[model samples]
Target: MAEESGGEKTEQPTPKKLQDAAKKGQIARSKDLGTAVVLIASAASLLIFGKMLAIAVLNIGQRLMRLDQKDIFEPNSMFTAWGDAGRELAAPLSGIFLLILVASFVGNTLLGGFNFSWEAAGPKASKMNPMQGFKRMFGLQALVELIKSILKVAVVVGVAYLLLKLFFMDIMALSLMSEPNNIESALYFLGWLFLGLCASVSIIAVVDAPYQLWNHTKQLKMSLQEIKDEHKNSEGSPETKGRIRRTQMQMSMKRMMQQVPTADVIVTNPTHYAVALKYDQGKFRAPVVVAKGVDEVAMHIRKIANEHKIPVLESPALARSIYYTTKLDHPIPEQLFAAVAQILAYVYQLKMYRKGKGSRPKSLAKDLPIPEDVRH
Candidate 1:
């Protein structure tokens, strides 16, 4: 006898498995989270170091061109220095910029699954169906976008105003001095202000980016009813389900009777029911249900048990209880504990008697009492 045994082998990953992965730190954030982190970092780096980087380039290019001391400060020479510096810095700076951009794009794509669908970019037929179009026109998503745009404008304007005020403070301090080293002092203050603005703007980007990403993902969750409808559509109707269940039961019965040769005993209703129990000292703490059957299945169970030289006993109540409650490879329930204990004791006594050791059973045998509520 053989069952369709494939169901046990194809294990499904349950929700608990996902939770365990998270608990073990095996989970990772989506690509959006990585993109947001990189963007905020880049914005900060540019804001703070832009002036310092420009000054460094200007100094290097002036030395390389060997500009005269007087010509260095002249308007024509200053414009030439700027153009030369930009040209000289282009290779290293452009390479760095391209690297950062590529890294950010790759990191974000990995964190977030590839969301390359064009339909997600704008309104579509399915999304516009009936009342959905009205909802989309005045939805929370639209409101959030409006707020984000307003906040971005406000932040940029405020940072610019603060930078101007800082510039004035540096200028006023310079005026109080007898001989102001104009270019050096101006560049130093500009560098400081640039760094400050960059730091502040980045703080804003860091907070806003993740919030926007989270809200976007939340809109993609499927509804419960949608899951149920998919399951029914993929499987079949109720009648087809019942037929599959009955076929599975028949296959299970065939496999169960095949294990009877390995059983130690069969407790039975003599005709209508059978339950085969197997036990070994240290192998099991109690008897295990190796097989069970009713009607035609019972006849097969009993026939196999007889052929295998295993003991078969008529115990209608125990057989029925085992059939209803104990599955193959499971222990009998607590309510049937006493009855099973008596059967085990009797079998052990018969083995001792056959060995010609004293026919007397263990004193603990008195402790085993059959339950009164057991029905025949």
Candidate 2:
């Protein structure tokens, strides 16, 4: 159905997809590489410690065979004999086991590093589904695995045959020698045979490593829709992001409107722009823009200022400068200091006149000390 619907996987897998796959223990790893390493390690360990292992085995065999009838009849004596035999075999057996263990660890690490995932280890009912099991068994992946197994076995057998044929003369000559000489020669021949077999398997491992990685990557490939969905999941859906931005802007506007009522005076570009300013002689060194906006938000600021009875002044240059250059709750630029100071003084005097403490001040100067560069 997926194929019919054009859901073919054509896109490269994203980093997030790869990471998720790793978390599920679906990383590329070659079991053949591990098998080859173990085989080689085992062969090498035997070559290095074969003499010690032979001596230990001979000693244990002799001791068991030389046991007297009385020793066998007595339970304690029989137990003691078995314990001694175990001690004789312990060193060589432990060394071989350790070698194989280290080899397996190194081989696995070289491919995928260590990974732990409960999801991979846990049993699932889907695995027991007959259709699913049949699909898996007859899938392309299974076919590839079968072909690899066949090739590996055929290569190993061919190597063994060639090695035996090459050493056939030496093996034939071994029978002409004494028993001890013949045994030593046979052991040497077997070591070389083991090494040859390991070499053959290593070739398979080298080939299988890249094939495994390619297969794993192919399995993880994404379709166009899958890529789009993954990107949306990572970055947030467009509609959700747009809603968040709108909510933030609404909150900011509400906060700005709240600050407008506290402003000492409002500056306006008549209709387009409004900027509310506040200054405290003891608390603030300069007038700070309490609220500022253009268009609909400008009208909102002006309406809030009127409700609070804050003085409103028409200063197009000052309004534009404050609106463009200052942020809410931040002081106006040094270039606008003189012009702002004039406005503040006018407002202070007007307040005193309204309270009947002083005579009305002259109307604010038409040409306030606005800097040429400061005007937008």
Candidate 3:
């Protein structure tokens, strides 16, 4: 249905989709791979530790066989003997089983890392529905499982048949051999058989692992509409983004207005542009534009400067240069330093004159040294 509405699932699953699926325990897994690894590990443990295990078992057997007629007659003695035999076998057996356990964990980790999810384990309505169950019973996965089972049975039976045929005389000779030698020979035969069986299962694992990975990727492939929906959900719609941008601009304008009253002077294009400059000898080596804007915002900055009694100067080239080249709360360029310094000097003089502390200062030059490169 998604394919019909949104085109084919041509794109690979995105990282978010893969992560979400893993959180739901939908990671790819190959049971055959894990089973083959455990079986091989078990075979290796048996081959390496067979002598130790044999010695342990032999000790228990000898202890049992050395029992007196009277000892067998007593139930308490029989229980004591069984307890001693269990203690003898425990160490070697535990080592072998622990190796196989570690192998099982490592095999599963090979593909999917380690992921567990209660959501995947929990009961679902689809799982309980009769129609769903019927479909699952005859699904492609079920058919594949059935074929694998048949292949495994065939392979094991064929190998067992060949091994028995090749070793028939040797097996018949086992009955005539002495006890220790017989046990050793039997272990040798069993180890070879176990290794052969593990090899057979490994073939199946090799085929199944790649198939499972490809099937997992196929299952998670997204249609165009799903990709579009995920994008929209994560990033928001165009209209919502536009509204957010407008709100941010309004808030920024308000903040810029708040900084206007703190400015040392306002340079204006007289109608179109206004740039508020501030300088402190201890804080900055050069003048910084505290606020800047055009048209209505320029008008607002001039009105705020008037209310605060901050100096307002009109120098269209200097204003245009600062407005175009400098960002708010950042130092003006080196090219504009001379022009800014002259304006600041004039402002200081104008302040002293207003307080009746000095003679009226000469007016600032009309042609401020605004470099052509910075004259926007």
* TM-score to native of every candidate shown: 0.48, 0.71, 0.84
lDDT of each: 0.65, 0.87, 0.90
Indicate the residue-level lDDT of 254 in model 3: 92
Q: Could you tell me the lDDT of residue 52 within candidate 1?
A: 51
| Candidate 2 lDDT tens digits, 256-360 | 889998899999998999999999879988888889999898888889888989999998888998898999888888988989989988899999999999999
List runs of model 2 lying over 4 Å from the truth: 1-6, 38-106, 109-114, 160-196, 229-239, 278-288, 329-331, 348-362
Clash totals, every prediction: 5, 0, 0
- Using TM-score as the measure, name the better of candidate 1 and candidate 2: 2
Model 1 bad stretches (over 4 Å): 1-43, 67-229, 234-244, 333-338, 341-368, 372-376
Question: What stretches of model 3 exceed 4 Å from their correct place?
Answer: 1-11, 60-91, 166-185
TM-score of 3: 0.84
Q: What tens-digit string does per-residue lDDT give for candidate 3 at 1-376?
A: 7558677887899888999999888999999999999998988888877766877788899998896988967879978888999998898899889999999999888877899999999888898899999888999989999998899889888887887788888988989998777887777677777877887888888989999999999999998888888889789999999999999999999999999998999999998999999998899998888899999999999999999999999999999999999998899999999999999989999999999998898988999998889888
Candidate numbers, best TM-score first, in rank order: 3, 2, 1
Better candidate number, 1 or 3, judged by TM-score: 3
Query: After TM-score superposition, what is the CA distance of residue 131 in candidate 3 from its true location, in Å?
Result: 2.3
Q: What TM-score would you give candidate 2 relative to the actual structure?
A: 0.71
**lDDT-based ranking, best first?**
3, 2, 1
